[model samples]
Target: MGSNPAAPIEVHDLTVAYRKKPVLWDIDFELPEGRLIGLVGPNGAGKSTLIKAIMGLMPLLSGYVRVYGQPLEDRRELVGYVPQRESVDWDFPVDALDVVTMGRYGRMGLFTRPSKEDYEIAMACLDKVGMADYAKRQISQLSGGQQQRVFLARALTQDASIYLMDEPFAGVDAATEKAIIELLKELKSKQKTVLVVHHDLNTAEEYFDWLMLLNMRLVKFGETRDVFTQENLRMTYGGKLHLLSEAAEKVARQ
Candidate 1:
């Protein structure tokens, strides 16, 4: 589909490379506002790379990205990001509450301390992710799921209009997954846009209202029911889709 000026995220001809080897090629798509979007593909398909590109963390070899029809730098405050759990330095010497408090830095004046309200907001966000009890615990001391929950709390503290999350569900327990999906739905209800880099084919259809299939390039971008087809799966995954196809079929049947 053509770009939507009113879309939460509009990426056009985006290309990213490392050491002159392309990781993402000519990616172009506009994400609808206030919807749950899934970015799915095989390993090395550059799903995480795409998220970083939109967040302006990665240098683009070509094209551009816009948030709410404005340059990312102009609307940076409106976007929140949650990097993959694996990418975080969990061993950092900081408590869960301290980590969540950092999310407010974007809104705070430089060199200024967090106000009481900021701390209250951070605590509330931690509570929302079921980690208020562990707010004072060192991040390195928490379990994998707990660490992820703390990061989610950090993102919530931003209270941005759009959120770009990288595999928030990876390696989490079922309870954490349930909690995360519930929180994502709540964000949607509040008319906030969320984009997640996801790997679970089994739960993708159930989790996202929109899907963007990619394999270093755009395969399809549309409603989940329209884009999550066997043909598109084959095109996106090729020989890697045999088992994933069976799982997708099961989800469809359900």
Candidate 2:
């Protein structure tokens, strides 16, 4: 275990299951602060499950998760999460600004409305993501990339020390992908820790300083240079040849 009490995230003996079928088993890792980390694995390998368990959004079958050396409940305000785009209900009645303002709910009391400062902050975040012009647009009316940007702005409004995002780049134009990565780098410059669920093996090392290769277990977790080896990729993907070749070429190019 890390001796640093302020490690961004720590999980010990963590396990989670669905319908009595284990998805994550005895997962354990302690993350350092101020880095962009990527969680990569094959589909159904429990990548999203791990993030949910860490956020306390799922019932853990056993073990525990700690954030900044405290239980998630005590550190809720310090963490922010952006769920997968597929998991969100874009049809719900809300405008872009309204969605971003919801991020401030954590700082509010029950039944309290957002104050002026909260709206200001939300607008600022929206502007940061280049969605300020669409503040009044309905969420469902926006393009996929625009919707994703709105969600990222919402996470930014929380101003959290740690942010966990699930597949933020799953589907988007190249410009949007580039913009999101740039925003993530900005967060890193502020010494914020970010863990992203990434699907593209070819870009994993290019995007993150640390890589966590998971396949229903903690296959490998460490600096990207050390953990992005061929053996680790094979273990994580069960010898998927094409992906391996692509990743190898990416590494060679770098």
Candidate 3:
């Protein structure tokens, strides 16, 4: 199939498996550019897995992902990723500014080190996320909300056209959540696409303009008001797929 230039993200026949068990199956969807999208699903519903596959971090069992009508590898510079906070080793002895500087590494190349201007850019991004004062503080010393802000700062430094974030609001305080929502709005205003893996059903409608509901498959994907209905929520969260749930549980245990 031909790629859609207008869509910032497109997944065709995407499937991911672990040890012969499928996590996401036959996933297909295209996200419009410049919108805040929420990937909402239950635990083990392959939210993180889908983002990983799109980023080319995980081996796809089958199918393809395209960003701006190009393969992910070809479009790496155009995409920024904010991984789950738990995925990182916070105690690794890196300060907040150092962590944000890592975002510029992609643009800096393998041999060149971050220059003084790069540090300025990183600090500017930290200030955007309201974490400039703690730039020199160790990442481990920051609270959960503070750590999340730092990660966002790093993504901002990438200056990408599309951003994929995993559970950004999880464990954050109300103020942090509000700040993130505002940042997302700013990105949208600038015509950037953002796909966030979100867990809270209560605020999903309020936070995102679009929604992609997944349950080991594509249940629905569209505008929030149209797809974020009672019936869709039941299909996503309600216990309708016992076998899939069992497989997901097994994979989680591994």
Better of 2 and 3 by lDDT: 2
Among all windows of 10 consecutive residues in model 1, the one with the lowest summed lDDT is 245-254
lDDT of 3 by residue, 131-237 (tens): 99999999999999999999999999999999999999988987788889889999999999999999777678889999999989989999999998877877887
Looking at model 1, residue 49 earns an lDDT score of 93
Among all windows of 10 consecutive residues in model 2, the one with the lowest summed lDDT is 245-254
Tell me the deviation in Å of residue 48 in model 3.
Answer: 0.5
What is the C-alpha local distance difference test score of candidate 3?
0.90
lDDT agreement with native, every candidate: 0.91, 0.91, 0.90
38-109, model 1: which lDDT tens digit per residue?
A: 999988999999999999999999999998899999998999999999987888899999999999999998
The local lDDT score (0 to 100) that residue 149 gets in candidate 1 is: 90
> Can you give the TM-score per candidate against the true fold?
0.94, 0.94, 0.92
lDDT of 2 at 214: 94
Q: How big is the positional error of residue 202 in model 3, measured in Å on the Cα after superposition?
A: 0.4
Q: How far in Å is the alpha carbon of 136 misplaced in model 2?
A: 0.4
TM-score: the better of candidates 2 and 3? 2
The residue-by-residue lDDT of candidate 2 on 198-234, one tens digit each, is 9887788899999999999999999999999988888
RMSD of each: 2.7, 2.7, 4.9
